[model samples]
Target: MIDHRRPVGPRTLAARAKAAVTLSASLRAAVSAGEVRRVVCLAPDPHARFAAVELGADFFVDTVLANGYGLCSYVFGWNPARQTVNAPAVDQFLGGYGDLVLRPDLATLAPLEPGVWQVVCDVEWPDGRPVPEAPRTALRERLADAEQLGLVPSVGIEQEATFTGADGAPLVPAGLDYSVAGLTPLRALLGDVHAAVDGLGLGAESARGEVHPGQYEIVLRHRDAVAACDDAMLLQAAVRRAAAARGVRAGYLAAEASGMGSSCHVHLSLSDPEGVPLTAGATPGEPSALFGHFIAGILRAAPDLTGIWAPTWNSYVRLRTAPFSPRSLRWGRDDRTAAVRLAGSGRSLRLEARFAGADAHPHLVVAALVGAGIAGVRERLPLPDEARVVGELARTPWEALTLLDSKPARAVLGDPVIDHQLAMLGEELTAGLDTVTAWQRARGDLRA
Candidate 1:
């Protein structure tokens, strides 16, 4: 929902500028003490670039952003194919990548440990030349837009992941949804994760086991849109590191061995500058007029936004086969099966987005959600009747790509985004066209 005129809210602009232009107190302390070995830049793809921390009179950023995972995906997934951390000559990768600069988001500076601090970085290019491929930049713009409209968007992102043995089996047994015994095996591991995020100043709100074996959901408390997305990214990294330390695998894969998918549901609400929920109706049990328009715009764009939700080839496979995945873009009051479920009533009203897989990018999801709703509000889009079940989500990458050209898609995501996404998906299809999967090997060998 990026408008042609990129509106900048005074409040969001100041907060963003503080992070971009000023050195944080923690960073200043490290720079002055020569304690920091490296300053890592966290990308949208969750990849990190560890560069030498220049301990001079003042802090400076010389890292370049180009041909990196920031704008492009890995050979297949969004992350590296191998588990590589700090390489021997990693500083070279942080060097020149054509021209774009990777500016450290000082506001996101947090201790990865003692001598290392991880931060989310935003891409900066020349004016009039927008890098639509920059996920962090896109998120900042979306938040600014929300603020300019005199609305405050609150978001809480809940992601489900699996802790499993090396053989790819769940650490605990299934059929123990929400049971303490079900989550007992990985208590220490998740506990470490909770502690790690706490060090980052974003503590975990709640944790629970799911019906899917080894699958557990970590709920992050709600915050402003930008901060909430940052929390989600950092939370995922903490979970992965915790799993590795415990000698178990942290699987955020959409589908697990048990045919259940891990979900990354976002609980979102829009309120006025005064902190009053605009989604609440004049009377109880009803929705505000603006809420209807918001939901309508989201429903209209859901078919196409599926490409962003399920970006990888395997992502859609899980949504199509997993037990708890949403069936359609249909929405209802407090409905779990619906893509966007309306939850709570009165001032507590919110939308629990149940469509995205565990691996979907948080910033992209929020941008599209807020942008589309704003469009509806601006254009006065009419609300449609709610069907228990309406249309199915895009079933494949090809389906998603085909729907990517729809009017609603362009309305929500501009042409540059659509084209970039199509290219990335096309790359995925080309990458796997000739490769044989293990499943194919097992099924086709010596058969017919």
Candidate 2:
């Protein structure tokens, strides 16, 4: 039951159309000037990056065709290993070999190679329908649902990653945990990253040293849910490019073999159409009924949504009992140990979701979070009492798979979308099971 009394915010349909048109014109001008030699288009998956390259001259005319019809199987051919999979017929029907439209948002375009400009694209079907399996589409659907409720959702993402120098050595050999000494060694790399992200128009709030050696975290200012996720993805890409330019590497892997894990923390809030906060109450440190219900929804849906938040096999490695990552389905005020932490007051009141790892897809994570919150509001779910400890979350990918296919996920994400996710994740799980890890080999050779 949406509150029909209020109107949609600035992100109305007409406004978006105008913005898109303006962006298209700008891209065409850049192409005509030969400022862009190669146009790199991309879309992201839960565990991989999908992309295609086009010559600049071809891009001008092809832009219309690509936006309307779509590129070839490039969107579907990519797998986690950076190799193409021989997708089944059913998969092909869904998205494996079909045309995928590339909508060029000027905001996401950034320089990569000397003459190459990369633009992050949203994948859609040939007829302009959003691909259900696409991460960006998932987030957009959830945002639309929130809008229908007369509420606007905003998100700020904090992502951490490890940095290695040209010699493949850790920038910091020991944990400093936010110490200035830890940041001093990596100033050059961090500086480059800041400049790159700023050039792309991603307003980076701050960059700081994290708990692990050779690790750093960058905070992006809050924005609408979809833009926030897009900024997060673009920020990650920018950091990587910046590091490479400085003769280093930036890894977003959840956990290294012998180092602290990296995480992608999401801070979410809801506001009314008039930009008034709906999350906080008049009293200090107290949340409104709407905020409480949203938290309740997230707790109930946490188990089922774990697969999206922690999508990879290595992702489970970071969900341990300690290390600042939440292992349980709990919520508390300013509590880092809980999966959801309440923070701020009045208009700034927001929920911090700490379950996601750096390796997870930003769009999918945002979708699961927002969708679950919407479900909570619809059901008028009750928030649990604040607690220091609670029941554990899904600990393994197999367990996450079971929870993802459960009734709760279907209730929120619909059958087709959940089914597609299950199929894709199932493939990754099966492949993982077939591989022999180093630990297995070492143990088996000595004992078995």
- Top model number, lDDT: 2
Given candidate 1, what's the lDDT at residue 41?
64
lDDT of each: 0.67, 0.73
Q: What TM-score number comes out for model 2? A: 0.88
Segments of candidate 2 deviating more than 4 angstroms: 1-16, 28-38, 48-50, 55-58, 61-69, 84-90, 93-96, 106-117, 165-169, 388-391, 445-448
Lowest lDDT sum, 10 consecutive residues, model 2, at: 1-10
Error in Å for residue 18 of model 1: 5.1
List, residue by residue over 292-345, the lDDT tens digit for candidate 2.
Answer: 888888888888878877878788888853388877888989988778999887
Residue 351, candidate 2: alpha-carbon lDDT: 94
The root-mean-square deviation over C-alpha atoms between each candidate and the true structure, in angstroms, is 6.9, 5.1
Question: Which RMSD does model 1 reach against the true structure?
Answer: 6.9
Can you write out model 1's per-residue Cα lDDT over 1-448, one digit (the tens) per residue? 1011111211244555565444455455555676766666655642221222222223333223222213222211232343222322222223343344455566666666766666666654533244565556666766677778876777888888888899888888675478886667677887787777676656567878887888887776777677677778777888888889888898887777536788778888787766667888887556788878777777777777887788777778778888768757777888777787888888778888887888777887788788788787777777666655556679888888788767777777676556656666665666678579888898998596
What lDDT does candidate 2 reach at residue 407?
94
Q: Clashing pairs in model 2?
A: none
